[model samples]
Target chain A: MIALVQQDGPLRIEITEGVIEPLPFAIPTFQDESGTAGAIADEISRVIAADLSGTGLFREIPSTSFISSVTNFSAPVAYPDWKAVNAQALITGAVTESGGQITVKFRVYDVFSGAELGQGIQIVGTTAGIRRIAHKVADTVYSRITGETGYFDSRVVFVSETGPKNARSKRLAVMDYDGANVTYLTDSQSLVLAPRFSGSGDRLLYTSYETGQPQIYVMDVGTAERRALGTGGGNMAFSPRFTPDGQGLIFSLEQGGNSDIYRMDLQGGGLQQLTNSPAIETAPSFSPDGTQIVFESDRSGSQQLYIMGAGGGEPQRISFGPGRYGTPVWSPRGDLIAFTKQNEGRFHIGVMRTDGSEERLLTASFLDEGPTWAPNGRVIMFTRESQGSDGAAGLYSVDISGRNLRRVPTPDSASDPSWGPLQN
Target chain B: MKKITIAVMLVSALALTACSKNRFNGQDGTAGAGTIQPGSANDPSSPAYFNQTIGDRVLFAVDQSTLSAEAQSVLTQQATWLSNNPAYSAIVEGHADEQGTREYNVALGARRASAVQSFLIERGVAPNRLKTVSYGKERPLAVCSEESCYAQNRRAVTVLTSAAGS
Candidate 1:
């Protein structure tokens, strides 16, 4: 039955099965129903094309090569003209601005079948948040064709770094998934790292040196108001990830030079020690179901991944490879754990099954660590730093298939990205 | 009778807070902060003397927190100097080279700092005069990416301050 559908199908790329080659698509310049939004319409069209093309699953056919122009969004698509240009998908849109609000309506068409894949959508957002509007439109288009959730309508919290390596200053920052509208949450007076968002994307958990030691700090993403978490600030705590329930946090707490994974109640002020070995145990994350946790430990004499019951039990070692693994974040899909591996003086971003099989390294760099999952669980964003005195860190994303590696644009050097859940 | 019990409870809580303050020099205001003479590097009992004559920092091997003979020797002197100067407290800053990831390097630096804290305690320096903070590879003393710079960057520096409570 599947083969029958594909044989006479409207062009579709199986993102999970893997696209052998990028599917060719064309998106004409969006029409501006309101003459005042002509430039905005063109920009929205360009952004949508770029978003699809950036996935590496779609190759956008340039407007210069288009045989038929989409001067009217409601007009019937010319199938033969699109076929002549070898375009598999066609998208047309229109943008209108009234008062202080802007509206964008778009439709995705399977050029071969000459039919709209889904009902048209008109997204409404403020003029100040025009980029978000474009992302939403692209998300609709992407989901209509790929039959999967879109990651375009998302945000990432990262640490923006500046100054020389020896005296680098860092601030907590958040940006759009493509690195737009960067807003700094904290100034660079004190160093901050590893900002992980809550389940609802309304709050963040990160490590800050505000009290003269690395302590977990919780922040309201909207108001930027933050306070020290009750995880024993003087004892030194870092690497905190919110529990699946978002009512508590799982993090590493250091005492007398030894570190261990722990979970704490965000409201009741109860602390649970999850790991109690003399060896370093840090970077704990819970599976989506919240029954088990995946963490990295050096109890085996070198860093390796381990899985244990969330309530604390004898952990089973899951990473047996030759390299050291740290920062193991359980994928949202619950089947894989993404990690940072260091071996032979080089670093990598890799993923493996929960049972520790079918390991695949997605990126190798001089310094790369801290993997954060996109909402869809198909993409991973991590920090990549260069080598030498002038070394700088930047955020990069790679799909689960290990294709489409692209640097996330930022106004300054950024690292330790925590991709937030899809926005409402 | 209930009022009397409440008064006793408040008194005991005040006493406990006072006892906690004894752990650090001058923590209860400026008890010992004034007498620790602000002498230059020449004064035998001054923090400057301890920093210059006795090394202020000790280096470690890559990813290793175990102290070397050289690092141990320097730390031994530091322990004695800390014992001699009761009014000054030290913050041991543990650091790692840029060869490791951020979170792991932080753990490694903590181990180095803790090692120093243990050695100092063993050599008769009061635990109350010492605190530890790990910067991981965030703050490096040497800027280059070579081994020489990494060797220097992987270190534990004992910074002194008067009336320190942390």
Candidate 2:
């Protein structure tokens, strides 16, 4: 039955099932004789190779398999030697330490084309920044080839869950975009949900039931202090998100009995209602330009996504495919909106153009929702919860092309992820 | 049958009173009291008796916001009991079945609580006497992954506080 159902889903299945050529590349360890600088350099190369190889976009040639030493940064042409090992691309770099600071320089060459694709130099405060430097180099190479920004330097904020399912304790946690350096941002005993980063990655807006009511609160990511926004008495307010400009917030406010979308100034007072309909309107996200917004509402009787002007204009329905859609987050590029769709008893994380055309569901499982774009918009991170016994939720990231599915390490079960922009 | 009729009459009266916005103005000013325990006022064998005890929480299907008929019946009985005890102002805690996104589930939980709140109001309970909060899927009543457990986790719970007591 599942096979029969899969046969009818979409046209991409046929294209995805076909054989395709994998990009072959070679990464040589940095030549730095002795000590921590050399060790860090080698690890950086390894991580960069792993990041690229894991994307399924590149096939890395083992260092042991290489026919050439690539040790000298100023070495002459060795295209023939690289080609002998079936390498299409070659990356070589070196590391140096001076004045208690480290500098790493790397270069990418298209062995097949016999031309340098890109080169980069990074200076780090400590050995730990070597990995970040490596990531930046990888981003540079990736963007040069794909014509899209890389997402490796960003971070994600999500709800970390522990304890029994019925009485789970949840805290807001943040981690590097590649799922390293996990840190807890809030220690509230009450539940925290739907965290979103300001464009600067310094402040976050999320909903907390700490006061016995669901209210929107903004917290400094570094200080952990928070202040409530708006005055809606005790009515429910949730799904808080910041405007791209960081000057305002868009969220859902439940008043009287109806839930509607509203936007308020981040610094203070007055509230402006965006959607005055009787339908449940929540999960509002702003476009990169801040002139438009995308959110999920049940105005059509079932939860679907809609896009509208930032100032509350006519909204155009963007989701028409099977199942219900919710949690629509606009990409920082302003070109796509990532959302969660529930269809045929299964959930999926998908992205569609701003107008909702060409919808592509990236990951499908018992449950997958709350997709937040990596700062550069090349990847999406979302929570995937398994079903039945042993059921648990964890963070997962996939390229926008629907490749490189990998689990992000978290201290506990995580959900409702929101990715912050690249650190300055 | 006699007991069922009496319970239905009480529910109808409460539902009627809920529709009027100012219905709480004439009641014992202590309508906000929150100390009424569930299942304490009826025969122990009666379904309504569960209202006086810590009532069981209802579970929901994945990504669903609508209450099942059984859950609605539970809420109806809860509303009827709240009407009978005027001193008990209750908070409806909405919860999800653990199958959707946290934010959406929070919203879904709210919709569930709102659905129950509107139902109770339509059945004549005062709006001020009832408040709603959504826990999304954060607070579950059951921990298992089976349908039996999931059903119990998706629920709108009536938490009676001391504020309603006169």
Provide the TM-score of chain A alone for each candidate, in the order shown.
0.97, 0.90
RMSD of each: 8.0, 11.1
Clash numbers, per candidate: 0, 32
* Top TM-score prediction, candidate number: 1
Model 1: DockQ vs. true structure = 0.24
User: Candidate 1, residues A192-212: lDDT per residue as tens digits?
Assistant: 889999988999999987666
The C-alpha TM-scores of every prediction are: 0.91, 0.82
How well does candidate 1 score on lDDT at residue A309?
97
Interface RMSD of each: 12.5, 15.8
Per-residue lDDT value at A213 in model 1:
82
Write one digit per residue (lDDT tens) for candidate 2, span A223-288. Answer: 666787864778888888888878888888887546888888887566889998877788888888
Model 2, which residues run further than 4 Å from truth? A1-20, A33-36, A119-122, B1-87, B118-129, B143-147, B164-166
Native A-B contact fraction in model 2: 0.35
Retained native contacts per candidate, as fractions? 0.48, 0.35
